[model samples]
Every structure is written in C-alpha cells, then in structure tokens.
Target: MNDKLRSKIIIIALAPIIFILNIITKSYPEFIEKYYSTGLDRPIRQGLSIITGVFPFSAAEFLIITLVIILVISFIVLFIKIVKGGFIKQLINILAFASSLYIIFMIFWGFNYNRISFDKIANLKIEKSSKEDLYKLCESLIARANTLRSKVYENPKGVMTIQGGYKDVFKREASGYEAASKIYPELGGKYGPPKRILLSEKMSYTGITGIYMPYTGEPNVNINVTDYMLPATAAHEMAHQRGFAREDEANYIAYVTCSMHPDNDFQYSGVMLAVIYSMNALADNDMESYKHLAKTYSEGVRRDLVYDSEYWQKYKGKTEKITNQVNNTYLKSNGQKDGVQSYGRMVDLLLAEYKKK
Candidate 1:
C-alpha cells in the first residue's frame, strides 16, 4: 500500500483499539478509579484548563463554531465529489477523520466516563432514598432556601435576583468551588472560570443550562437562564471541568459548592436546586405528601419557584425536546444507561449527605 493509504488504514485500526480500551476500563472501574482519576486525569485536566483559562473568550465555543462550519463545507465538497464519481475515496477520508476525532476525544476528556464515580470517591451511601427521607431532605432544603432568599437581593416583585447579573455571577463562581475544595481537595486548583456563551438565548431555547467542553477544558454557562439557577448551573459545569463526568455528580458538586458559598444568592440557588430534585422525587412516589410540602414553601420561595417555572415555560418547544433527546443519547452512549434520568440521581447524593449530617 502507498504511504497515504497505509496511514489511513492505521488510523482506522487505532479507533477500535481505543474502543476496546474503553470497554476494558469500564469493566475494571477500580483500576481506572485508582490510576486514571487519581493518577492521571486531574493533572491533565488542570493543565488544559489553565492553558485555556488565559483567554477571555471561550476557546471551546470558538472550536464548536469552527467545527460546524468545517462540517458543512466538507459535506458540500463530498456532494460534489460524489457527482464526479469519487465516492469511495471520500468515504475513506471521512472514516479516517472520524477515527482521529474519536481518538482525540477519548484522550482529552471522554475517558473520565471510565473513572471512579463521585459517590465512591466521596464515600456516599447511595442507597434508594425512602419517601420519608426524601420529604425530610426537601424540608431541610426549603428552610435553608427560605433563609438565604431573605438575605439576597430581590426584584421589585419580591423574587430572588442575582444582584449584579450573570456576568458577575460568573466572576464570583470560583469562590464557590474554592470553598468546596476545602472538603474535596480533588476539585481544587485554578481552572478556567465559566464562560458566558454569546448564544445564551439560543441555549436557553434548547433547555441546556450549561455545558463543559472537554476539548478546551472550558465550562460554558447559559447566562440567559433565571438568576436563581445560574450559580448552580455554573458550579455544575465547573464540576465537569474538574473531571467529574457523571451528570448527577456534577449536579451534587454544584449544590455543595454553591451551598458553601459565602454569598446568600448562591446558597439559596444551591439549596433551591436540591429542593427541586428532592421534591420531584417525592412527587413521583407520594403525591399527597408532596402537595402538602409544596404548600408550606414561604411566599418568597414560592414566588421564586413560580418565576423559575415561568421562565422555562417560555422555552418549551420541539427544539428543546430534540436537544434533550440528543443529550440523552449522548449520555447513554457514555455508560449513563439511564440517560437524562441519570441527572435525577443527584438526589441520592443529597439524601446521603443530609443523612450523614
């Protein structure tokens, strides 16, 4: 074979090797947990994040835009090639590119899927939470949320608001993570602060609050979301940046990080997130008790929850459903077999922590 063809064949061969390695790692979580999470992933993610953090704008966002443009142009070119009867050569090129991208993705951040779970690392007792435990968790979260909401700024209508706006929240987010690191030093270290997406409004329509771009090691947040959610969402993405791969773990990290924040707004937001998840679980299992607990929310908490509901209400559409499905598929492909439902698993961590305390 010619050198170019030989190179293409080698690239294609390497993809399966990486796939096999991924399977092996999944089967040996203990080894991946010990060696990859503790020994390798942290340092690599930290280094990438530091390098990317130097830029004021998001390198990940830029990369995404560029990739989309490249894909579009490549498809146009491929169409023209097919018309000219060069289909086989173009197909080979596409396969090689796919293989290279897969390898790069795994090396950078995808391997975290194979690392130890946060529950294991945190030593959380992640048993199925009982209805009573769920209600108690909701009650605790509600009380804390009520107290924190009072200390935070409010809109003229008496709903909680971030005093300075989303940009300010982004700047302040690191302090939350820093406070959290006191408890889990693994999440410590300087990394890129969360970036505000320029297309945040578009992101809101898709029902995505935040995303961690593993390629650039940047956490990007949708600033257009309700102020009550911005802090927790930012912390959640930051957890992913810190190498916690599971959506539920990221959510729990965000809750802990924001709850520990000195700012009441963040604390309120964090507790409110916990309340939402816990209450939803309760609603699923014990409708009467959930309704009773829901009615007990302080006026301030109720108003904020209503405002949050209305904010999301405006964005529900086919686009949101499609985006959610895509995200669900992506999560499942990465071993989150429950897919989007895996996010609800954050309640398990919350319940375990509350029970411990």
Candidate 2:
C-alpha cells in the first residue's frame, strides 16, 4: 500500500479504538478504581516537586514550553527551506497537519477518557446498598475520627508546631500523615505509597487535586491547598487515595474516615469539613443553628475558607468568565443540569443517604 493510503487506514482504525476505550472506561468504574487508582500519590507528587523544583510549574507549563520550542525550530527549518526553494512548503504543510491531528486527538481523549463521571458509575452498581447502610458506614467513620482528634489535640504542640508560617502547616500536615501511618499501618504503606506530599506551592482555584493511588496507573492528585485552607484539604485528598472519585463522595469519605482515624489532626480535619457542609445544609432551614455552627469554627478554619473563596474570585477574569459560561453550556449539553455547579449537588445525595440511615 502507498504511504498516504496506509495513513488513512490508520486514522480509520483509531476511530473504533477510541470508541472502544471510551465504552470500557465508562462501564468499569470499580475495575478502574481498583486497578488504576489504588495507591498513595504523595511520592509521585514529591518527585514532581523536586523535578519542577520550588518553581511549581505544572503540566500546562511544560506543554507551553514544548510548543514554543517546536514553533521556533519549525520556523527556522521552514525559513531555510523557503530560502532553498522546492520541498520547503510541502514539509511545512506536513508538520502543520501532524500538529493539528495531535491536538484533535488530545481534546478527544481528554473529554471522553480523562473526565470522571461518578453519576454513571453510581448507577452501574447492580445491588445498590440502602441509604441506611451508607449512613452506618459514615457513622463508623465519624466515630473513628473523633478518637483520632483526641489523641492529636492531647499534645498538639508535639504533633504540630504552629510557628505562623505556611511551611509550618505543610510540615505539620506531613507529620500528621506520618503519625497516621504509625497509628494505622494498613492505611499508610511502606515504600509502596507516596512518601512526600506535593502542595501546589502556588495558589489554585480548585479545592484539592491528588492521585487516588500513586503506585496504581491513576494520575497524581494536585490539591489546591493554599495557606488559607483548613487542615481538612489534606485529609480530603487522602480520601481520594482511599478510592472515592466523586467529589461529594470524596468530601463525605474524607470527613468520615478522618473522624474515625486514630490521629487527632485527621479527626479535627474531618469534623471541620463536616461542620462546614452541615452548616451549609442547616442554613437552608435553621438560621440560628447555622449561625451557631459558624461561630463554633476556629478562626483558622474560617480564614482558610475565606482565602479559598478569594483565590477563585481573582480568577474570574473576563476571559475565564466567558469560558466558564460556555463550559456550563457545554456541560448542560451532556445531561448535566445546573451545568458545572452540579458537582456540589453530590452533597444532596450524601445528605439524603445519611438521613435515611
């Protein structure tokens, strides 16, 4: 076969391959969770930290750098070819076509394969556990968190050194993870799990991002735990390590798991999140209770929440605002109502499940 004909055949074959992969990924949540996302992501993140050094450059940064280098090289080659005459234009055309194909494939794979759809996964379970069962599960987690909280708070200074700097909080969190592992060996593995956690040294708009499992094939999670967030953000990412992919499920699991754990820091982090969400729930009904709960939170948690909000607010630039508006429209196009904000609705399902129990 001619080279052109072979290229066409390859493109045709890729279409079906992409479709098959999409179907498999969408249909097998547990398989993916268990096989691809069941290890600690801290070490991968730590390596990324070292590789990127203190600069905190992201994948986006690397991509941008790569593109710039390619463009520069391409321009130089094309200019030389133009000066030489003949095949220069053809070469440039081939390069442009290849670059375009690469971009299209990236967009296709990103939207279809990279994105997580928890609602679809939840629906796939044949024997749906009752809400009461979920509640009981949550209760057990909460009980465990309470136990851990007492221990950490017993000698807070010993476990955590609060000297006011942001690095101090990172150190404290790292210590808490170490303590949790010592207290519960099953949760924190040796060597197999990530050793050092990576914080997006720069601020992020998202609450937290991390790989559910680093040893597994899953991607690393990168938490947007700026200096202002409550300790809960660390525990929340840890919940992802435990195999909760759904945002609300992660939030719920983080609260319950941390609450149940033997470490005081983990317990406090979990309860703090629960209190925040529960307060939001109560605000829809009892204003007085919401106010009381609001007051109950420590100044640190409140400040963190406020900081988290402000960070996102800054990113609402005109370009991002317009992009978000279009993105919401696109999300609604794909069976999600309330557009992108529907992620927060996971709380409704969690609350209902808790109440039924």
Candidate 3:
C-alpha cells in the first residue's frame, strides 16, 4: 500500500483496538479491583520511589528541567532547519508538528478513557441495612479509633510535637504520589506532586465537588458550605497516603477514621457526613432532611462551599467540559456507569463492610 493509504489503515485499526480493550476492562472489574486493592500495585511503585528519593528534586525543579531541555532542543533543531531550508519552511514544519502533537494527545486521552471506566462504581447497589445497624458499626469504628488514639498518646509528646505534627507527618503524607509512583512505575505520568491543595474552590463542571490528583498526590477537597466536611477530606487524603487508590475505599476510611478521632469537630463532621449516606441507603426520599442538615452547617462552612461552587463555575470553559466528558467516558469504560459520580458510591461499600463486622 502507498504510505498515505497505510497511515489511513493504521488510524482506522486503532479505533477497534481501543474499543476491544475497553470491553475487556469493563468485563473484568473485579480482577482490576483486586489487583489494585491487594498489594499487587506496590512493587513497581516502591522501586521507582527508591530512585526518586535519592534524587530528591521538588516538583517545580523537575518541571524547570523538563522545560529547559525541551526549549533547548527545539531551538537547536529550528536553527538547523532554518540554516538548511529557510525561515518559512521551519515555521510551517513547527506548526505542523504542533498540530500533530495536539491530535495525538486527544487520541491518547480518548484511549485512556476506555481503559478506566467510572460508571461501574456508580451502578453498584448494596443491600439496604438498618440505620441502627450502621450506627452500631460506627460505634465499633469509634471504639477502634479510641484504641488507636490510646496508642498515639503512648508517645503523646513525641506524636504531637511541632516537628512531628507539621513537619514529619504532613511531609510523609504529602509524599503520597512519590511513594505510589515508586511502587507502581506504570502509573507514573507527567504530573508529579500537585502544586497546590485548593480548598473551598469551585470546580468547573460540577459547580461543587472535590478532586484528588491520584497521579500527583494533590488533594483539592472542595466541599459545599460545610466545615464538617474538612476532616473527612483530610482523612481521604490520608487514605491515599496509605496507598488506597480506589476513591470509595478512601472515602470509607476517611469517614471511619475521622469519626473515631478525639476532637469533637472531626467526630461530628464524620458522623454527620456518614448519616448522609446512611439516609441515602435507607430512605426512599430524604433530600429534604439532607438539605436541612446541610443548612445546619455554620455560615463560614457555607461560605466556603459557595465560593468553591462559584470558582468552578467561573472556570467552566471548553477545556474543562472536554476533560469531564473524556473522564466520564473513561470511567464508563472501566466499569463505572455514572462516571465521576461513582466516587460517592463508597457509601454502599462502607455500609456493607460495617454490617459484616
């Protein structure tokens, strides 16, 4: 075949291959869940972590290095091309290359969607458990937390010291992405650690939502007008630090751990939040109660939630819309039916697990 015809054929073939992969991924959700939840993903991440630990460059430093190398190489190539051909030819070539890169990026993003469906989680249904039973489970979790807290106070001075609290614990937990990448090299991507933890910020499409950068270890927990939600977000990030990649598992851990905490604020926030899910599971129509409880939050928390909603609304551009669509598609391909909303499905899992115990 001619080169043009060959290229067309290759592009045509790509779609079917991606489709097949998506089907396979969706077909075996359990397998993928097991692989991630078990320690299977750890070895690759751990090995890469050792190398990065030794090198020790911050995220910004690494970005600077990458940009410098790309610019230097691009300048050298352009200079050579200009000398050999002409300025017009080099400019045309650069534009063509840039266009091609954009196309490739879009195509790869589409494929990535096929590989990681979110809808499966959204579609999952759990057997309904009584509120009393769930509350009992919560009490058990609280007891467990008390036990853990006792352990923490065993070295109370050491655990609560400024060095340990702000420096060590925070630093270690924040290094979640680095640690995950070290253990699972395949999961490593261009973004390393996230640059910032944007709190109470609005997201683009959802108007109000939380986002965690699983690849970068950045936690942007955008909650709607609720100080009670902050501790859960913190606990969610802590779950990521402990290597729980699935959103639902992290949510479950966050709810349980925070509820168990000694601080009243944290416990109140955790229990109240869990009640939202418990109601969802049990009540036929509880949106009224949900709204009432949500309104009970302090004005400060409500302000944060509103600011967060507005923030995302302001940034809801074409880029974000495209990103959401692609992400939703990807989640569906991976076994999640409701796309990103599947993250909230953890409520069912948490209820089930609590009942089992």
Candidate 4:
C-alpha cells in the first residue's frame, strides 16, 4: 500500500513487458539489426564507453565488487529480519531489484543477441572444413606465430612480454580495431580502451581471460593471462563492444583485427589465438597431423606456449568446472546452442576466410 511497495510492483510488472520485447527481437533479427544494433545502441554504447574510459580503473569491476558486498550484507540483514519473523517484505525487495537488472540487461545488451550474425555482416560463408583444410589452417598460423615471435620482446625466461606492459597493450589495442574496421566496417566504431582488472589473478581461477561488460560498454581483461595471449584476448572483448555478441564471432573479429595490426606483438598474439583453435580442432580430428605440425614451432614460440599451459594448469579444478558449467548454461540461454563449445566455431570462420585468401 505504501509508495515504495507500489513502485516495486510497477518495476516487477515491467519484467513481462520486457520479456515480450525480447521474444519479438529474437523473432525478427533484421528488425533488431536495423533499428537497435546499428541504430540506437551505437550512441548508447559509445557514450557509456567514453564516460567509463576516463577512469583509470575498471568501473564495471569495481561496481561488481560493490554489488557482491551489498548482496552479502542484504542476505545477512534479511536473515536477521526473518528470525524476528519478517520475510515477505524483504523477499519482494530482492525480487524488485532482480527485475530491474533484467530490464537493464535487455535494453542495453540482450537485444544484441538477436542482431544479424557476423558471418552475414562480413559476407563470409561458414562451412565445414575437411581434415586437410584444418591441417592447412594450423600450419599457416604456426608459421605466422613463429615469424612474429622473433620480432617481439621476451623476458629473460624466454616467455613473451608486452613491449610497454599492460598500459601499452591497452593504449595500442585500439589500433588493431582501427585497421580491421577499414575492411569490415561493421566493427568500425571506436570505444574505450580495455581495462585491466584489479582482481585479474583471482579471475584466472575461473578460466576467464577477458570479459565484456555490456551495461557499461567496457572491455575488461585479466592481465594474469600470458602475454602471448593478452592482446588477442583484449581484441576479443572489444569485438563484443562492436556488437559481435557471439563468442565465436567476437573471436573471429579478434583474429581479423590482430592480423591487421601494425605491431608484431599484436599480430603474434592474434596468430597464436588462431593457432590454438585450429590446432585443437586438428587434434580432435587427426592427432598425428597435429603432432607433426606442432613440431615445426620455433623454440621461442614453444617456450611461450609451454608457459601459457603452466600458467593455466594451476587454475584447473572444481572452481573452473563449476564456472564452465554456469558459462555453458548462460551461453546456451543466449542462443549459443553449442554452449561453451561455440568458441571452437571460430575455426569455421577462420577456414572460410582462409579459403577466400
């Protein structure tokens, strides 16, 4: 009966309205592509990105930390109230807040899941490749990675290191998008630089290298990831900013942008991304061929890969398994039917582009 209760009911009511709109968007991809993705969403994304970009730290990261703390405090208070026999009121307050997040997510980023796919936007045909095709793709990536490895700076341990550390990496990553956007204008807009997470080391345990915060239009990267993979990972998150919502498509864009980059470090990281994917696909089909081609890796490239393996090995366990399960469900609900496996679909994009060249 109070104004607060009435407002919560009104906000919760919008959930169904938004759900209907979500269905409409999903049903009409062309409509969302024309009206939302390339139209209204551009300014929204760019504006939020510009505002957030001014800050040196990750606004989204800090916001998440704050929210988690608040949530814990809320549950504690709710429990104490329940012990005193107050429950329904607290429950309604939580539900109302949840409904608001759902609304915001749909307005800012959820509709993007319905936009025209990157393959169509880029005019590339994705087809299943033969084993030989996979083998050829892996071979080309390995060769490129080897050549670029010699060009980048490496630590005394022989592992790759960014020329200017993370600051330089963040400063320079946009250049890759600038170069690639010329060829594929769909990913053309400039937004904020990627923000390095203060909790990056902790995030590594969940196996997430980079993540895009759609609400703020910010690309967040885990600096704890190996340097050999960092630039490409940054580009991957940026692709989400350009409206490539699918993991596979974002990955393909990362490769395109990285290859177009002038710096050898960016190009090398990009090639390594492709190499790992193509080689994994090849191994899945023909382990003998994968083993044979991997032997051709340069000593520097091999050392970097080994370090990358070791860096991630320590993070594999129950935490990663649970995280992967949750991510799989999230991706599936958002139209990635293959779930986490959709990431490997980037190989199809690579093979398609390879055929064109």
TM-score of each: 0.95, 0.49, 0.45, 0.95
Q: What does candidate 4's lDDT look like per residue over 182-280, in tens digits?
A: 878778886888999999999999998888887788999999988888899999999988777888888888988999999999999999989988898
How do the residues 4-92 of candidate 3 rate in per-residue lDDT, one tens digit apiece?
A: 54555555555556457646655554654455423443343343333333433333234435656866776677888777877654554
RMSD after Cα superposition, model 4: 1.9
1-357 per-residue lDDT for model 1 (tens digits): 799988998999999999999988898878876787766777788888889888988888889898888778777778999889887777778779789889888877778888877777777777766678888888888888778877888889988887789879988999988887887887888787888898889888899988898788899988888888889999999999987888888888989999889988888888988999888888888999999999889888999899889878989999999999999999888888532232257887888888988
Clashes of 2: 20
Once fitted onto the true fold, the runs of candidate 4 whose alpha carbons sit more than 4 angstroms away are 339-343
Candidate 2 runs further than 4 Å off = 1-12, 28-231, 235-244, 284-289, 292-357
RMSD of each: 2.0, 8.6, 10.0, 1.9
The CA lDDT at 81 in model 4 is: 82
Report the alpha-carbon TM-score of model 1 versus the true structure: 0.95
State the number of backbone clashes in model 3.
Answer: 30
| lDDT score, candidate 1 | 0.84
lDDT of each: 0.84, 0.45, 0.45, 0.86
Query: How far is 294's C-alpha from truth in model 4 (Å)?
Result: 1.1
Expressed as tens digits, the lDDT of each residue in 1-357 for candidate 2 is: 777755655655565565466456656645544443432233443443344434333343444456678777767777777778755454645455454554443222222222334434333221233334333433443454344434443223222212343344333544444554554342353222222234443323332234333223122334444332234565555544433334465565555445555545656666656655644545655566456545644444555456556656754456655656775675454334431232144444444435444
Weakest lDDT window of 10 consecutive positions for candidate 3? 153-162
